[model samples]
Target: MGSGPSLLHREDIHVVIAGGGYAGIQLAKSLKNKARFTLIDPKEMLYHNVGAVRSCTEPGFAKRILMPYAPAFGQNFKQGSVTAINAAEKTVLLSSGEMVKYSHLVLATGSTGTFPGKLPDEMITVAEVTQKSEAVLKLVQEAKKIVIIGGGAVGTEVAGEIATDYKDKEVTLIHPRDKLVNGESSDAFQERLKEVLQGLGVKLVLGERVTNLDELPTDRVETATVMTDKGTEISADLVIPCTGLKVNSTAYKDSLASSVEDNGSLKVNNLFEVQGTERIYAIGDCTNIPETKMAYRAGMHAELLAKNILAQETGGTVKEYKPDPFIMVVSVGRKAGMGQKGSSLLPEFVVRMVKSRDMGTGRYWKEMGQKPPR
Candidate 1:
């Protein structure tokens, strides 16, 4: 209630972070000691969705997967979505009809994948996403014939989780390309993934694109089928679409300093700041930063941006952001997984030991400044 820990008084250094996911939260933590921070998000907690696929198989772990903001920051958080932003005015209009002013703004608004609509327009908050994820888990539990559409990380992980855990259920992974995780991963990694899937008795349907989903009979559980471009019908009782995500840059569309990409990502300069704009930055999947849209990368971007902004405020030269090479640690269940570390493809057993064994609870513990399990 009082003016507590005023690192910035009378608009000294007010950093208004737009999203409280990995990027925003990491940025907030990085600057918590140096600035008066206000973190805004619609959800009360952060969904650590990197471990979400595993959570589907082990439903009880969901509680441990979420990170709450209030406990992490004392009285520096707000629960509301930013409905609009006026860059010229340096103000963010919230869904609660409150306008928050900022000297520097970090647009870590992130992205949406499952929602089939415009970015932010059809956006579901973290809470809703988690709830829907629970429903998805339940659906998987009841489903006998499961078909996952997309061969990306999320899709592959989902398929692997279902196939390895639900042995009796018929699982099939459908991809438009000939190999899973097509362009993002190495050939060795792809082959290893296919081998793991085959070992788990998971069927792989490749080189086919879904053309129709309405042609299947409605009565039988196995009657639900997808017609591919190759004129093949693949049947399933449940269909999970993990295609891709669109950046949430609608609020920044009209801002003079920001540019939107064809895929709906915001264009940011080398400093991780939105180009053509002063004191405004964008990070994570919402920005065209030439890196994988993983949580770790977002956190790194936010950390660099926070330091650069602080240096700028002190009349020091801003730091340039160097993105790390993409690394993928994918799980095939609790005991097996695969990893692409920098350039080398490793076995699933190594990946499981590094990531999947604890479903990243150890990572969360470390992020929260706690010691990981022994």
Candidate 2:
């Protein structure tokens, strides 16, 4: 009864979701019986991107990192790269040379990266995740020295995961800033993170920049040696860049009616509706939501968008989105993490219990109506 022949026979109030990320699928499942939904993305599997850092280092965990979408969504899920979106007409064009029409559209194509933040560019299947995860593990296994650029959440967490798994390897973390995790966190939290990472044998090279990536001498595609701004030369068998998120915003450029942000996200009103548009809404990393881009925030946005859309259908008063206090967490390794929940520094045990134990992937699978990997 979730989605199949019975649902297809019903009349269409088509809701086409342009991405299979957390926001897109959450809205689709929440609005299950309320509308005819079509969720589209290029990858055959919906990614638990947060777990990729640890999964890359501990390749055995790859089995728990990916889930195919077809099982959860049935026939309503479409696997194809969205080439374009016609926001005015509420239609999406896929790479399969097919056009999907909709009465409502929600764009939630979350940010991606060139590194472990997302899967490799050519990888689109669950099997590819496993294969590439093993390849990444091979890189970790083969390298005696590892260099991580940026001291943000992903970079720091990756460093910890690698150090935890391979204690013999020399791991160096370089950042231009004086402290790690500078955004939306306190100095106490930053100091604690520094202490934890340093205790794990991660060399913290702070307050300096690795400014010349192109000039680095490469031993291989995975290995390089570079000079820092302070004239220190560091050589590593593997270099990983977790610089930041790059919003995937080019697809809807023509359709967004000149309201796209310079950073490749759409500008939206407080209700999470795209500015100057009525039927079209935007959420998650693809929107200028003014909050730190986190999975929980995206889930809240999806719920709010669904509620407002449902209200618009039934002629009821639409509810505005009011977010809970910001909670920030970083999974240092499989059993360790650091976090702050609303101005209180969470204890290490609390961080491990909440996120680092399994990276919140089980809860995500539960919401998606799938069994977690054993």
Candidate 3:
């Protein structure tokens, strides 16, 4: 709402942030000095609320989770989606055909996927999240048998949300892997969720492959069906796919192709600076930072980037971003959750209270410098 609390170093130094997600907005607000900032994103609100993954099954939280971006960054926030980046020229081209020049550029545009949670592109407005949440609530209300593909965080959370909200509805979570959140969560952590999901009456279809979500047929009977590779035909009132999210790496693949992986994720050195570039930096889902691509890790990347960029300008020391030991949560419902911080296991009651209750919804509003929930 007010001027950045820190002092801008020079009048000429400008920081152009690509996405208005957690990292982009954090860097914009944290930067000090006379440094100018231009945050570009098509969406009017920041949709980092993972709580909405479950809350959308309910009516009240489904509407309250999407926070308006206008309140996050006042005059510095721009309305557009980035189409291209010129590391040599130090400029970013917007989809609107406008070129924004910056002394230092930070790309925080997270990944996109087919799911409603994975945005198709830079979003058009903040209202879209609210609309999707409302529609999902309606879907849950009418659907009798709901099936979620991928037992990862999103699918499991959705199952928990729907099962918790509508006790009578049949919910199922199918994962091709033996364990949930295979590369991310520990085995003990996944076991805890398996218990929670099954306890809530969610059918578990683990270690089974669903060939293609498209081939799944839904006839005039108003029911959904998908055939598994195991030759088991699964039927449901609703089928949702939670996999398939590729890195949004196409923007720099031409000139900086070597610096990116096959997955479209840009490679960076320890400093979070995009390799082979001087002033350009990439963070969050787009970077190959070896850690889980969650909001908390993105915030850490932004903090390190802000510090390092400022140090480069002010002749100070820059820090490298090594993800702090694993800290994650899985919300089975607003009343149930499980997670671990470092080597310590989080109790169900604490998880429920700290995260599952409001899914850290209020704290995110505060992160954006908005009014706390009433």
Top TM-score prediction, candidate number: 2
lDDT of 3 by residue, 1-374 (tens): 13423337477788998887778877776772346788887878777557668645766675556677677777788888777877778888887899989998887877876544565564466566666666667777877887788877777788888888889998878889888864567778877788888899999988898886785522222476777888877778777677756776545667577787888888888887788888888988889877767887888788778777767787777777677787777788888988888767788899888778887787788887887544
Lowest-lDDT window of 10 residues in candidate 3? 215-224
Q: Candidate 2's residue-wise lDDT over 1-374, tens digit each?
A: 23322233446578788888888878887777666888988889878887878786765788787878888889889988777877667778887889988888888888878557776557899888787777777778888888888888788988999998899999999988887865678888888888888889999998889987666432233556766899988888778777767888756877674778888899988787778776778888898877778887888889778777766766767887766776788988887799887888988998898788888888888878999877
Which lDDT value does model 3 have at 261? 84
Which runs of model 1 end up more than 4 angstroms from their true locations? 1-11, 115-131, 214-222, 256-258, 315-317, 347-349, 369-374
Residue-wise C-alpha lDDT for candidate 1, range 194-290, written one tens digit per residue: 9988899889988888776455432234447677898888778877777766677655665532377777777788887777777888888889978
Worst 10 residues of 2 by lDDT: 1-10
lDDT values for all models: 0.75, 0.80, 0.75
**Ten-residue stretch with the least lDDT total in model 1:** 115-124
lDDT of model 3 at position 244: 56
Better of 1 and 2 by lDDT: 2
Q: lDDT at 286 for candidate 2? A: 94
Candidate 1 local distance difference test against the native? 0.75
Which is the leading candidate under lDDT? 2
Clash totals in order: 1, 0, 7
